[model samples]
Target: MEPIIHGILLAFGLILPLGVQNIFVFTQGVTQSNFIKALPAAITAAICDTLLIVLAILGLSLIVLQFDWLRIILVVAGILFLVYMGKVIWTSPAANNKETVALSMKKQILFALSVSLLNPHALLDTIGVIGTSAVKYSRQDQLLFTYACIVVSWFWFFGLATFGAVLKKVTIPQGVFLLFNKSSAVFIWGTAIYLLIGLWQGAY
Candidate 1:
């Protein structure tokens, strides 16, 4: 019971931070014509998290992520990708957005996977936090903890998507979505710059 509760709390703590993955899910929710249309993003993000959590707990990180150079590579790749995405978002014309339809499931899944899998912080959280925490538990307790964590990921995504959907009542969704894209661009660029500075300072 304690382990279950601990897992939930840990997951919440790790995921509550504003990051690329969370923002992706939230933006999908806001831009999608309906909450149902946002499911692909939520599901894909959750699936990526599930894979990370399982592999982290199974000690794959110890085997494959032992090299500092590998971590650096991931950091560099993530930064480059984020910077490009930020520019795309910031430069997208708002006038064309009103006619935009909900994202196809394929695009949603791909985008979700990109943000969820590529984020260096998410990888660290999986290995450093979830993996470490699971090591202290018995096999049965580990299963319970893992399940709780997975559930939290799914719930959080849906909750975020729901919040986005709710905004439809307050104003024009296309305008709100365009505004969100700009905000998301700022966030992505800020994160990229922070990562670059951190790497320069050997903060990683």
Candidate 2:
């Protein structure tokens, strides 16, 4: 029970922040025509999170943190991906347009993968925090803790998507969603720049 509680709280603390993964999933929910259409992004994100959590607990975190070259590569790739994602988001059509085509299933899965796996900060957090936390547990306790975190991740993303869909039903102005796209793009770009600076400073 302790492990379960700790896992839930830690996972929530990490995931509750507004990051690229969350934004993309929520926007898909808003832009897609229906809940089913929005699910690919959510599911992809969940699966990625599950993979990360399992790997972290199994000691991949320690392996990742050891090599400076590997860390640099991850940060570089993350920055490039964020730049491309920002451009894509900025040019996206208004959510309220009847003809606004949401991301295709393949694109959704790809985008979800990039946002989930490319972010070095998120990777470090999972590896550093969750990985370290798991060190205190063993066998069945470790499995329980890992499962708790994974479950929270799945539920949170689905809920985020659901909330976006609900908000879409509210008849907000088209321009508002357009502005959201633009703003989200700017935020993503800013994050990329921030990461680049960190890398330049050898913070990664």
Candidate 3:
């Protein structure tokens, strides 16, 4: 019971942060023609996150913690990727059209994978936080913890997609849409800078 409560709180704490995965999932939801259109992206994000969480529990987190060089490399790569993504978001062609081009399921899934799996921050959080938490649990408890975390990822993504769909039906203002895009860019860029600084601090 203790593990369950902690796991739920911990999972929500981690997922509530607006990183690339969360931002993209919500964006797809709000932008897609129908709420169901965003389903692939949300599910894909959950799957990728589950893989990371499982790996974290299986000891990949320990390996990452042991190697400072590896952490630095991941941070650098993430920074570059995020910068490019931020630019793309800011200049998205949908700015002038509420009925933006709808993405195919394949594209949404692929984008979800790139943001969830390839994002260094997501990887590190899984490896460090989830892994660390697992260490305190017995095998059975660990399984419970993992299960709780996975469930949160799935529900949170779906909820975000649903919220976006609901917002669309209510008719979001054009300025709000523009603001979301701009805010998303800023969030991504800010995350990159935060990761860089964290690396610098850790190195010293």
The per-model lDDT (C-alpha) reads 0.73, 0.75, 0.71
Ranking by lDDT: 2, 1, 3
Query: How much does each candidate deviate from the true structure in C-alpha RMSD?
Result: 8.9, 9.1, 7.8
Q: Model 3, which residues run further than 4 Å from truth?
A: 60-101, 169-204
For residues 113-178, write the lDDT of model 2, one tens digit per residue.
999999885786677556655654557888888999999999989998898788874555668657
The runs of at least 3 residues in candidate 1 whose Cα sits more than 4 Å from the true structure, single-residue gaps closed, are 60-102, 169-204
Which candidate number maximizes lDDT? 2
Could you tell me the TM-score of candidate 2?
Answer: 0.64
C-alpha lDDT of residue 14 in model 1: 64
Q: Per-residue lDDT tens digits of candidate 1, residues 1-204?
A: 966876776676567654667767776787888899989998899989999999998773454346667656656765776677668767765422222346889999998888998888789778765665555456788789899999998898888888867875344545654675677577666656756786798854
Q: Candidate 2 lDDT (Cα, whole model)?
A: 0.75
Candidate number that wins on TM-score, 1 or 2: 2
Q: How do the residues 140-203 of candidate 3 rate in per-residue lDDT, one tens digit apiece?
A: 7778888988998899999988987777645555676566667657766665565567566773
**1 versus 3: better lDDT goes to:** 1
